[model samples]
Target: MGLFSRKKEIMVGNICPKCNMEFSEPQRTLRHIEKAHKSKKKFECNSCG
Candidate 1:
């Protein structure tokens, strides 16, 4: 192996639904989604027109 040679990084984690960000840990991904994409309302309500 050369001095500058490096091993390839393997991504083994969950991906965010909203964004395509990868996380090594499931908990971290969940936390990031909650904090980054937190909705103002607890639930979304739809009304019939």
Candidate 2:
């Protein structure tokens, strides 16, 4: 049997633009960008903390 038996999973987060992984939080998103995507772009959200 295949490991994935259902539709693709949906994740929530700011798109890193580099790696394209969904992040649940801002900090994690930033980390992913920095560590994985190697993104220097800054992300500032007014409604998010």
lDDT of 2 by residue, 1-49 (tens): 9786996544536766565777778668776755765436477778983
Clashing pairs in 2: none
Q: How far is candidate 1 from the true structure (C-alpha RMSD, Å)?
A: 12.8
The TM-scores of all predictions, comma-separated, are: 0.53, 0.40
Each prediction's RMSD over C-alphas, in Å, is 12.8, 12.4
At residue 34, what lDDT does model 2 achieve? 55
Q: Specify the highest-TM-score model's number.
A: 1
Give the candidate number with the greatest lDDT: 1
CA deviation > 4 Å runs, candidate 1? 1-13, 41-49
Give one digit per residue, the lDDT tens place, for model 1 in 1-49: 5999886654435898788899888878877877898878566658732
Estimate the overall C-alpha local distance difference test score of candidate 1: 0.76
Candidate 2 TM-score over all chains jointly:
0.40
